[model samples]
Target: MQSAVYPSLAGRTVFITGGGSGIGASLTRAFARQKANVAFVDIARDASRRLVDEIRQDVGVEPLFLACDLRDVEALKASIDTARERLGNIAVLLNNAANDDRHRLEEVTPALWDERIAINLRPMFFAAQAVVPQMRELGGGSIINFGSICWRIGTPDLSIYATAKAAVHGLSRSLARELGVHGIRVNTLSPGCVMTERQLRLWVTPRKQEIILSNQYLKRLIQPEHIAQFALFLAADDSAVCTAQEITVDAGWA
Candidate 1:
């Protein structure tokens, strides 16, 4: 599908987390196509390098791919610093790193719970913290935090993921209020059942596919590009006044 070119995005610096695979990879490709200077961090070196090669070949631009573990706040900050040093000031931050690893309630130990929180929620706040000064210096910016519809739908086997996703909205709203004065917009971008490679392999069986199709008003699968398009609007000047809002790309599943 053809998409709009956000003139405002050209030359702007964008920092993304977990941008090696799945939906994060889609965001990296989409933003790079718009002529944005994209810098993304992920621990998946192979996937990240492949994605960079793909984007470079297809879009004629290569995004800066930094290997990072989001659970390490200091490392996360260092990644942001690397982006600033190489790509210029960050104008858009897509807090898209998250793990929706399903776990039963009984299986959640304290260490496991902390690990879940670290992957699904903590990085978003700290990443936002790291970029605020850069955004402020640039006059204004956008922070699009990823949320899951699992929480709203109360999907089973994702207790910790859903809980962390639920917390994302509160974090976003709070950040919006605090950063609005600095012209920084923070909002949650929630997506429904997307058929990413990981999801298809681990979760989407025939019955699961049928259930997803039947529940959402639209009968088609939610693609990463669909989320990327909505995210483009959020990150661009088009949604300049939109903040503290929960935007869903669920195909009406919610």
Candidate 2:
């Protein structure tokens, strides 16, 4: 789908995590098309570099790609600082990094549970912490935290992940009140059954697809671009008054 351009996004610094592949990559391209200064961090160095090259050719502007593990709070903060120094003040932050690897409830060791929550939920807070100063300096900013419908759907085999995603709502609402006076907005962008390459390869079996199709009102798979389009609205001046909301793009499945 062709993406719409936003005058408010042009020249604005936008930071995205896990922006090298899957849905995050779609966001990288969408923001670039809007002429935003897009900077993304990911641990996949090769994929991240390829995405950087692709957008450079496709958009005529190279997005700053920082290869850093989001689990490392210090490294995450450093990468965000670098993006600000290179791109500009980050007025729009997309906390898109997460791992939804399915695990049996019984298979969750203390270490495994900690790792999952760290990757899925911890970065959202620290990244927000690191960027609030930048947003304060810019006078206002938008933060979009990526949540999932797995929790709301009561999908099994993802207890750890579901727990973290549910917590994202709490994070958004709490920060919304605290940051509203600073003109900063926080929102949870919950996606339903998005058919990304990773999900298609790893999880979308025939039976699961059938169940998903039967449940969704649209009877079509939600694409990563759909999420990106919604994100553009939240980042732009159009959603200036919107905050602390769970904006779902799940084809009415949620």
Candidate 3:
């Protein structure tokens, strides 16, 4: 692993959502390296447990893994409550859970649109709501949300996903304003085409890869670790003055 910009999360508790795999999982490991007490949630029980075990064995920091569907607001709140009781007050809340529905415009139904929004946008708000009070008691906190470059430069079959991520940007800004006095910072980490397992399985074809690389200045895929590094910055004291802003880690694609 690369050297951490801000080390020594020795006493902080970080709560991350969707941490079973992909970028969330990467963030979990990165924060653990800094010695943060990490708590993460994912509906996938096995994957979550595996990550928890790896962190414990490798770094000697046991992370709390909650199995819950984030789309269920009640379940999300309950999970957050449990995490707080187990890991102490949440010093960092990473709203990293999201879903992408790549359906053509004409193929999208009203029900599908609503479902996408609920999955991609609603959880961030509720997760933050659940953590804010705990953070307030702890004297301050950071909420790092995951946004997408697809929202910035439009994608063909991801209309609803794009719209939902754009709304996340708005949520980050408004929450930053609302929580500033309470010492809570809200920010969006917008990533470009970081090739993950899911993306390789569902989106990255030979033709698609060629097209995506053609638009980027670097012409190389961005790694989850790159975004993980940025999330660490936003979550730690280094980004104390940074809030309500969208930090892009897209290899300058956008």
TM-scores for candidates 1 onward, in order? 0.98, 0.98, 0.95
- If both were scored by lDDT, which would come out higher, candidate 2 or candidate 3? 2
lDDT of each: 0.94, 0.94, 0.88
Residue 153's lDDT in candidate 1: 88
Residue 42 Cα positional deviation in candidate 3, in Å, after optimal superposition = 0.8
Q: Across residues 1-254, which tens digit of lDDT does each residue of candidate 1 receive?
A: 77899999999999999999999999999999999999999999999999999999999998999999999999999999999999999999999988888778899999999998998999999999999999999999999999988877888898888889999999999999999999999999999999888999998998999999999999999999999999999999999899999998899973
lDDT of 3 at 11: 71
RMSD of each: 0.8, 1.0, 1.5
| Candidate 2 to truth, TM | 0.98
Best by lDDT: 1
lDDT of 2 by residue, 1-254 (tens): 56577899999999999999999999999999999999999999999899899998988999999999998999999999999999889999999999988889889999999999989999999999999999999999999999999888898799999999999999999999999999999999999998888999998888988889999999887889999999999999989999999998999873
How accurate locally is residue 68 in candidate 3, as Cα lDDT from 0 to 100?
Answer: 93
Q: Least lDDT summed over 10 consecutive residues: which range in candidate 3?
A: 1-10
Whichever of 1 and 2 has more lDDT, that candidate is 1
